[model samples]
Target: MASGFSLKDQLFNREKTRYLAGLFAASHAGFDPDRFEAEVMAELPALELKQRISLIAEVLSRHLPQDPEGMAAAILNALPPPLDPSLSDDDFGDFIFAPLGELVELRALETAPDLSLDVLAEITKRFSMEWAIRPYLVHWTDKTLARMEVWAEDENYHLRRLVSEGTRPRLPWGQAVPLALSQPLPLLDRLSGDPTRYVTRSVANHLNDISKKDPELVLTRLRQWQAEGVQSQSELDWITTHALRGLVKQGHSGAMEMLGYDPAAPVTAHLQLGPGPVRIGGALEFDCMLQGPSDAPVLVDYRLHFQRPGGKLSAKVFKLKQTRLKGGTARLSKRHPLKAGASTFTLVPGLHRLDLLVNGIERGSLTFDLLAQAE
Candidate 1:
């Protein structure tokens, strides 16, 4: 990423706030675009990304009619044309319209849930309503799910994606819904065959979240989907790989087998680390050779056991290579970076370890010293 990049600014800024205000102003004669823009801008820069979204929604509540029907009408009318329908994938729509979903949640969740769902269905075409739909799922579980069953078959791909994305067990930055992991499986069953990558990716991610809690549940579902063959063989393969990513990192034998890797295959690994201590802001270079049965596929991954300040080691997994052995042998190498300045995780100078995993089995490991960067 470029230095000084601000995601919040890029997603929600003065221009975006003003654009939303203009849309509403055009829809409602009584709506004042300048006032709405001013109120949202006042706190938008000071707040974080999510807070900015709430700030805009709160401002909308004060400006728009308080009644549920009028509010819903204003929001729906204000929305720009639905995102291009010709595109098959990778269109997430605009971020400015997200507040519209939040506004719907605030104005009509309890008093007029059906109307709220109606508005969200339209608003989602301009932007995903994944976050807004969770409260309904938590409070009106059966009712909301019943509605989702209908949405799963909607003509709009975005609405179809909302069904899967909204129900994710571990949706990032999303509100937690208390539904049982299995409860949403039925909905996923319907969405698993969606032709759009946008929808299928969400289905895969939702299953990946479930795999964290119930590996067998996800494995079983994948098996059933494969047997049923609702989706093409290639597309289902993509979904299976994406959904089982977490389990693969954990060296789950069942997940490995499901992906057609033999966890118990006879394999031997030899690891060699580059000379000299690795410093922060430098790279940790290493190479390895694997000896396995000819024509057998191998899923190779390297785990780095990072040393923390208090002598505890935090392990992180990274993909190395995925290929079939040639002449019963394969060679792989990597140059992992050690950045001194990182936003999330800090690097500590100390002894660290790297372990090689092939087909969900640890084959070899070695230790190396990490040094502080030069001042």
Candidate 2:
């Protein structure tokens, strides 16, 4: 991202707002595009991204008919068209259409719950309703999930994705639903064999969220899926790897074994660190060599223990390489940059430690000093 990049401004600007207003204007002649655009633009610049979405939806609700049926009809009519059907993945549709989902959540959830689901089904075809659907899942859990069961088989991939994404335990910027962790498993089982990567990715992510709380449950479900032979081997492999990423980072033996890596493999290793102390803005280079049984697979990782305030240290894992030993030997090197100007974590100048992990086991460790950048 370039400097001074404002995501809220980029997504909900005057042009996009006008475009939405025009769509509604074309559908409802009585709809005032000017007022809709003006109200949205007024508070938009001051609000955050999600707040801007609420502002647009609020403004739109005032312009539409107060009656539920008429409001839903106008929104359905104003839609430009469902997003292009040909693309398999990465077509998230326009963010401008997201507010319409909020409109559905607001107007129809109470007076017309089933009708709200219907509108959401259509609006999701234009833009995903994952965020909007959470409230329904909470207040009308069984009914919404029953409807999602049918959607799991829908022809539209976006709707199919919502069956998983909407119910995810850890959806980004989404409200939580009061349901058991395994409640959505049946839906995931149905979607596990989805042909589209867009749907499968959501299934994988949903499983990943489940894994955080119950690793064994996720692993068991994966085993069941594997036995069913529903999804292709290659795709299943991708899903398994992605879903267990958190466990693998934590050196969970079950996760490593499932991915065909022997966490306890007998391997000898040595690490060589470039001369320190490394500056805050400089790179920390290192070389590592491993010796093991012939052709044994290795999942190599490194951990950097950083010095934090209050004389404590925090460790972060990083991937190094994934390869098999060639002639009983494997060598890897990396030039990891200790970047400055990071907004999340500040680099402190002090003693730091680096540890090498082979097949999830720490093989070698070393310590070095990090210097603050010169003014």
lDDT of 2: 0.93
Writing each residue's lDDT as its tens digit, candidate 2 over 1-375 gives 898998888999999999999999999979999988988888888899999899999999999999899999999899887888898998888999999989988888888999899999999998899999999999999999999999999999999999999999999999999989999999999999988999999999998899899999999999999999999999999999999888888888899999999988889998998766688999999998899999999999999999999889999999999999989999899999998979899999999999998878899999998889967
Give the alpha-carbon lDDT of every model. Answer: 0.93, 0.93
Q: What is the TM-score of each candidate against the true structure?
A: 0.98, 0.98
Cα error of candidate 1 at position 281, Å = 1.2
Model 1 CA lDDT for position 362: 96
Model 2 error, position 152 (Å)? 0.2
Residue-wise C-alpha lDDT for candidate 1, range 216-260, written one tens digit per residue: 999999999999999999999999999999999999999999999
**What is the TM-score (0 to 1) of candidate 2?**
0.98
User: In model 2, which residue pairs have backbone atoms overlapping below 3 Å?
Assistant: none
